[model samples]
Target chain A: MAGIGDRISGTFFLVLGLTMYLFVNPNYIESVNGGNISPNTFPNILSIIIAVCGTMLLFKPTTQQAPDLRSVAITSMYVLLLVVGLYAMSKFGFEYVAPVLAFVIMIAIGERRLHWLLLGIVGMPVLIWLLVTIVLGRALP
Target chain B: MVELDTILAGFADAFTLYNLSFVLFGVVLGQFVGAVPGIGPIMAMAIAIPFTFGLDTLPAIAFLVGVNKGGLVGGAVPAILMNTPGTPDAAATALDGYPLAKQGKPLKATKMALFSSITGDTVSDIVLITVSAPLAILALKMGPIEIVALMIFAFSVLAGLIGNSLIKGIIAAALGLLVACVGQDPEHFTPRLIFGHWDLFNGLPLPSVAIGMLAISEMLRRMSMAHGNKVSSAIINLDTGNPNDQRVTWSEYWSCRFTLIRGATIGTILGALPGIGSTAAAFMSYAMAKGTSKEPASFGKGNIQGIAASESANSAVVGANLIPLLTLGIPGSVGAALIISAFMIHGLQPGPLLFTNQGQLVYGLFGAMLMANFINLWVGQIGLRFWVKVVSAPESIIFSSAILLCIVGVSMATSGIFGVAIMLIFAAIGYVMSSFGYSLVIFIIAFFLGPRFEKSISQSLALTNGDLAQILKSPVAVALLILSVISFVWFMRKNNQVNKADA
Candidate 1:
């Protein structure tokens, strides 16, 4: 799992760098500053570093001394599922999705009491809504 | 002479009912988070950032500055009471402090720590206010080249001397510099590394990155460590048969008066140097005291003087770290970095312009720090017993709570999905490194400084039309470069001496 994670993250950095170098053309530079260093210099620098570091990590990877496989797997799955739920709920409308997703995550993490889950599901969202809607006066998306 | 007019003006602004209340409010909240082991001032400030959004600028920052000050003192309480340190900086305090407690001198040790911390912090604040005026004047004369050199110096020192191993520290710093490179180049708006993801356009939000790297990873480490320990390790040793065992007499405190004063000065100077945090300051002071003390043998065994030096130095760092943040717009430590983010949220910037343009907020923040010390003294004493309880909370319960808070905190900072992804990735990396005794400090500091270094270098290059000689034209730049060389040599020599002494 550790090797796989490093591989994926490395690959992500590699492709990300390649795409950045390819897409941000000089013409775009004219819009920002009439052809100075391509606006892509900074990000390209980072991308290359990430790619290089990622590749090195993948090849001569540091020895793995992480936690037990069970915790890593369980935690990763839980986090991944939470992200998926967040997106799915946002598609259904963020207000409804946000509270529901939060509640479900709390419960899934082993909160036995419904009241505690309710705080996660209802209280947080409501408070956020109030702050956003009333305090900041920005409507909830 | 310290200008009374600026300070008086500051007091006027800070004395307002709203700001005063905020100062008290922030101190209490800051200490609450600081009392929890594995949650440091950096994480505390990051979590508090969002809450300052709608507040008036002065009050918002007043609250944050208060928190920043309170956190340093708050971290020491647990170190003295239990062997556990609430923050990495306080770990040095625990080395001698806990031993002192075991020897039935908890009160004296606690009182010494408090008094030394407050005194160190007070003197540092005076130094901060005085030194800031001159630094701000000097900062005005700097260009991109000088600033770039300074950042390089800062980055080098942080990576060079922080943690146990220099190699690991350098790696961590490199990682941070790399992270700073994310997003579009500020020089040109062409999106560089977003990879077509809109979310990546602004790069990673710093608060989320910090929370994930520092807080989430911390949670994982805590939980994993707990699994190995038996459940019974949770009970408190409430054997405070000597809560009053050895009161920190006026004479004892006075005896170590010079050490306390020297430690405070060292902490202030270190804190003023960017990227050197309170941990280094505390350890440096402890070493200084031990080396200079006639009874050096008592260092590890529970010396009140050791506790005094460590706690005082670390606490003094709180005020001194703000010098760079306020004068140069560069943070000196992780907590100061987070505090800068809060300032941005409040529509304030900490630079030369801050003194001239937002003088009120700048001085107001200084005033808040003074008030925070007083509040921290009162609140910390009252809250010590409760914090002692928290240190003994069941591992199962504490770990669970930490995990939950980590999840919520990270998610909230990023507003949902993508941020958590970044955090989990780093958590894995951090966990792997920690198990090998590799320093995460390098990665974290590197990630934080990467962009700054890049920006300064690129900006300087642009300004000088790629002329490298431009870097040497500025006296400050040349001086900083020289300092960097000196620091490198000094650190290497020190490392060699230690290794030889061990041999």
Candidate 2:
């Protein structure tokens, strides 16, 4: 799994570095005191270094234990839920959406206890709001 | 000479009721988080940074320092009790600590660990207080060329000393530099890679990137682990009723004094150097103690010196790691990096000017560190039982709430939803890099140092008119560049040897 991951990352970085070198604008109206190094010099140098390193990584692969697929799937679902909840909060308001998001994430992660679920669903957002608005005197999103 | 007036004033400031209370609070929270497996000090510090927004600068910094110091002592508890180290830095402690616990002397092992930790931390803090000012003064003499050379040396040391692959470390660092170029060009004030987004004009928010990569990504990774639900059922049976088993004799402690001193020294030196982390310091000290022991074979079989060595070294790193951060504006550890960001948030730039410009605050921070060591020792004794229970809390609750906090914290800091989205994006990127065995430490440090590096490079180029020969004219810069080359070669050689041994 690590080997495959490295291969993909290597290729991605390699392509990204080459594209940046080829396409990114290196032109500046004026350089720093007319020195040879431009704003693009640093990034261009870094891109070259990255491309070379990526190439080396691709050539000499290392072995590592594979990650669990079930865990990955669960983690992906949690991320998806987070994105959806954030979107919902943007459309609606945090007061309405935060509790439901917390409750849904708890359930998604296998929390089934009644009191814990209740606390997560209702109590968590209230506590956070109080801490933000009351204690810190900062308005919540 | 040290400024006695400033030192006294700093003590006066740090001993205030509010500061002390926050210090106590930080220690308690740090102990709880550190004693829980999968929640290390770095994560705790990163998560705590946003909360510090509400605090005064001195108290906020003191609070975070208290957390870091408390974590060093707290991590030893589970290592002694269940043979499961709460943090990686305490893994060496388990070799002798668990054995001692199994001998029905858990209290003795824990007490010894606590004593050694406090002793080492105090010594290292004293060293930091004394050494940092002089280092900063020396740094003030450096020109842009010297500063650039110094940064290069730091990068070489970091990439060489950390992680399995130097190439991967470099790649991570390069990626970080690229990411740091997202907003505006430092010199030209033109958009470099904004891609038409005005948010990118100010660059990615530091808090968002830091919290996402260091805290959120790790939380997600832990949530995905197969054994994420398997909380340890084993408990420490502290034979508190038995005096002989519960207490470390004065004689016994005196006998291990040399070992404690050696471990603390090793930890201080290594911790001050960028990229040599506490885990390495602890194991190195442990090995040194074992190698020098008269009964070497008995070293790992419940030897008190083993616990002393490991605990002292790891704890010492908490203070010593600040040496680079306070003096050079280079963070020597993940915790130090987070602290740097906090320093920035408080509008105090780290580096040489900090000592000259903010001498009172610097001394106050030193005083706060010394206070935190004592607080850590006192709190660890009273809160041991409470922390043990905290370790058993359900992962679902802790991580789920933490995720919410991450989101809310970013939103509150940025006053918009965009920062949270940036956090989520970086968290995904961090997770991918970590899974592929890239060094996130290198990446984050490089990113943090990126703008400074670019500025220094440009300044040096302008000063020297891009003349390669002019580099050799500055003795300090030449010496630093030479050291960088030597470190790079040594690191590659060491890595090659390790690879061959593994093969």
The TM-score each candidate achieves on chain A is 0.57, 0.83
| lDDT, residue B329, candidate 1 | 82
Given candidate 1, what's the lDDT at residue B357? Answer: 75
List TM-scores of chain B, every candidate. 0.87, 0.96
- Docking quality category of candidate 1 according to DockQ thresholds: incorrect
Supply DockQ values for each candidate.
0.17, 0.48
Tens-digit lDDT track of model 2 for B1-503: 34778768877888888888888888888888888777877788888888898788999999999888888788888888878788899999999999998999887888899899998899899999889989998988998899899999999888887787777778888888888887877777767777777887878888889988998888878877723353334555665578899878999999999999999999999889999989999999999999999999998789999999999999899889999998889998888988898898898889988887778788888888888988888898888767766666666667777887888888877778999888888888887788778888998999898988898988888898888789999999999999999988888778667756655
What's model 1's lDDT at B432?
Answer: 58
Where does the lowest 10-residue lDDT sum fall in candidate 2 chain B? B226-235
Candidate 2 Cα deviation (angstroms), residue A68:
4.8
DockQ category of candidate 2: acceptable
lDDT of 1: 0.68
Cα displacement (Å) at residue A3, model 1? 16
Look at candidate 1 and tell me the lDDT of residue B383: 68
Task: Please provide TM-scores, in order, for all candidate models, with all chains considered together.
Answer: 0.80, 0.95
Q: For each candidate, what is the lDDT? A: 0.68, 0.83
Clashes of each: 9, 0
The residue ranges of model 1 lying beyond 4 angstroms of the native Cα positions read: A1-36, A43-141, B1-7, B163-171, B227-243, B395-455, B482-503
